[model samples]
Target: MTSGLQQKNSILILDFGSQYTQLIARRVRENKVYSTIVSHKITAEEIKKQAPKGLIFSGGPASVYDEKSPKCDKGIFKLGIPILGICYGQQLIAQYFGGKVRRTREREFGRQELFIDDHADFFSGLPGNITCWMSHGDYVSSLPKGFVSIAHTLSTPNAAFASRDRKVFGVQFHPEVVHTARGSEIISNFLYRICRCRPSWEMGAFIKDTVSHIRQLVGKDSVVCGLSGGVDSSVAAVLIHRAIGRQLRCIFVDNGLVRNREPEEIKTIFRANLHMNLDFVNAQNRFLKRLKGVTDPEVKRKTIGDEFIKVFEEEAKKIRRVKYLAQGTLYPDVIESVSATGSPSAKIKTHHNVGGLPEKMNLKLIEPLRELFKDEVRELAKQLGLPQEIIHRQPFPGPGLAIRIVGEVTPERLQVLRDADDIFVGEIRKAGLYNEVWQSFCVLLCIKSVGVMGDERTYENVIALRCVSSSDGMTADWVKLEPALLGKVSSRIINEVKGVNRVVYDISSKPPSTIEWE
Candidate 1:
């Protein structure tokens, strides 16, 4: 979704480059109030134009005393809206209001106990003692004018302060993170009582508005959806079809990198169940030709992405008037491509649909699920009456099995990976753990290991099984499979699939290791 929408009664979060800035927005949205994240350097006029009912200053990494620290327009406080500052945001508020802030001798990095004071509406329904998540080195030394200490920890005396007259509040601990007990309740108090915001936002309303918006954007113009039989594209295609019924055409390209029988399954489902105009393109030779000797991950992604667009352009020529190209680009793709807060973050990897596309293309882009997380999209898919099979399908990268192979793109390697992956997933389903884990896949390693099979020395390729449980793809933890289950999978893979001998499970989490091997 674009940032230009004029959502009414929304909350504006001025991001100060915190890693948890997006979490703040997610928390606000969870409260059923629309929230948008913008750079801290946004001008006062822009804030006035958005006309938010509340303002939230997100936590940041920089100290407020630094000259280069990110700052918001001073005039924002004069907007007469309820304000809540978090972590570094609290320091900025204190410094702006004539309070002293200095680096503390000991930094509070993890969970800490907070002793609450008699602040009327700030801590309305909370107990005397609560746990909070704190990650800051600096603390407010003195209270600002007309503000009283609402809460404090052992080391941090002025942990939280509020000014009832000015409708301003500050908290040194992060209430957006799950580590803080009753964090949602505190945020709910701010939204419902302090900001006086109504809980009007829901997925149903979002669907209605997005459909209307899409219709308005593509007036009498045909749109083409690159359907990959995945949840994201399936939801996008169905939503766009709901808006412009006959003008939407779906193209399913089999690049020969997908799982077995995916193309035929997608065709049958879309045509028989959804009753939409669908086309199947067999460009496996085209994709494999361009990816003949490519070993670099980025090059493979770019080649696959560009080849998809070229194929789409060729198909668009056959259709009547295809002006817009629809994709199911989600919030994580945008966040990973470039930091949403305009801060410096390491580039994880390029999503084919997000960053690998060419600069210039024939079709304008239309992404309906851009602002949504994966779980939220699943909810939308369910609301739209999509079948359980599509709604609960495991997430597959846009580049398909190409990125799953570590070394190079070749027919022999692809077949080996495909067979092993099928067996792994089939076992997961048989164990009734398919829906329990977020993603379960097999990665074909480039190296080979020596093994004695039936008293014969043999060298064969090794495969790594990656199964992770995550609320969202941003962070994930490896799933701990039962020993019996693991043994079964290992035995089946080693016994069934040829050209491979070893099977191992990955135990790495997201921070040190990504879900995908590449």
Candidate 2:
């Protein structure tokens, strides 16, 4: 789906392998213009093919001094598109075009106050003493002829530069990340004033366009969506179904990790409101069989992943030549997985917590939400009139309870963890916390801890409850629950769930700890 403004104001972001490059695309989309992240090595012909209104160079973890550091061909500059260069991007722009760059004795990182000079086009509407995220080891010492320094930090004088005549802008700091206060406004300024893009990106128009796109892509051929009942997959299914009616088939395999009653709810919605083909497969036995005795987290992940693909392949084969495999792959995965930098994007964290997919699957992929962030997907979900239960459901990894259950996959353990998790989420919902928090769930630790219950010493599994506050799942801080609320949750889980003797809350955030333990 494309918005009118999105159609007209398309921006091509050349990836320099910056970890936050996808974050940049997310920020730009939030501003109401569609942005695409492409590798810096993308050919001039490819850029011409996209026909972007503006171009942006993403910052990378590389220094310009490195021999193999990423660089675009000189032809990119002469493309006549309004160009924006971030950190490494800025350094590349200057160094290649007769500017000087030097490694800093003391690298600038983390939060810094930006001092914007009136001459800077990128900071036209931005305020002085603005906060921005900086993560660069090298600094731009000089600018090419005709270019002017527009902004700077105390440590870095050439923080920002612009050549209004050429429509070229560069920033040494990242405006895509939240660490930069007013980052969104700075991006909007570039999109609206400099790039001259109209704010035509909207969710409603996107839905209409996506519906049309689906009709064209899957003409007369049946399309199958691998629904996990999560926001991403479900939203994709709804949009496609709206576009093509019964031609869209949603197959939900109960891989046995979903929360209580999710499969049933999913079936009811798709059958009643969506009027699409809904198939529910209880593949719990097959998944558990494949995961039996797998203790290593990585091994378990691979096992489950392989098994899921096999199951999907088998189901697709039975369907007699399924043309497309629809997924909920988001923009972050597309950006990070296919980085512009020479480095493998696999080094970065995954958008989905699930294990990698087997490469042998032959079905053509159809991912409707591939260009959107989690929040944007939600906006589209709301526009589609999906029930709040489905739309506002807390984020759950595709791997399901497998990651939550620290050890081997077994029916008994799955049941125990599922029950505890149900109580945990149920209480959170009872307190009106589901929509408020980004993710909230319970983890069943593999090790059994001793506890005293009434005069008896019981050896029981310990369950850890995790809840975090975040916009996207990229980075997060642990949610702060009141003492009363925590007490109630802890009491209920221990009392109601068998085999779970003790309950503890996970207070660690994403940096020191990932949302999931496994």
Q: Write the per-residue lDDT of candidate 1 for residues 240-292, one digit (tens) a residue.
A: 99999989999999999999889889988899999999999999999999999
Best by lDDT: 1
Question: Could you tell me the C-alpha RMSD of candidate 2 in Å?
Answer: 2.8
**lDDT at position 74, candidate 2:** 80
Worst 10 residues of 1 by lDDT: 1-10
**Least lDDT summed over 10 consecutive residues: which range in candidate 2?**
346-355
What ranges in model 2 sit over 4 Å off?
1-7, 106-108, 143-145, 335-346, 349-355, 448-450, 455-459, 511-513
| Model 1 lDDT, full chain set | 0.88
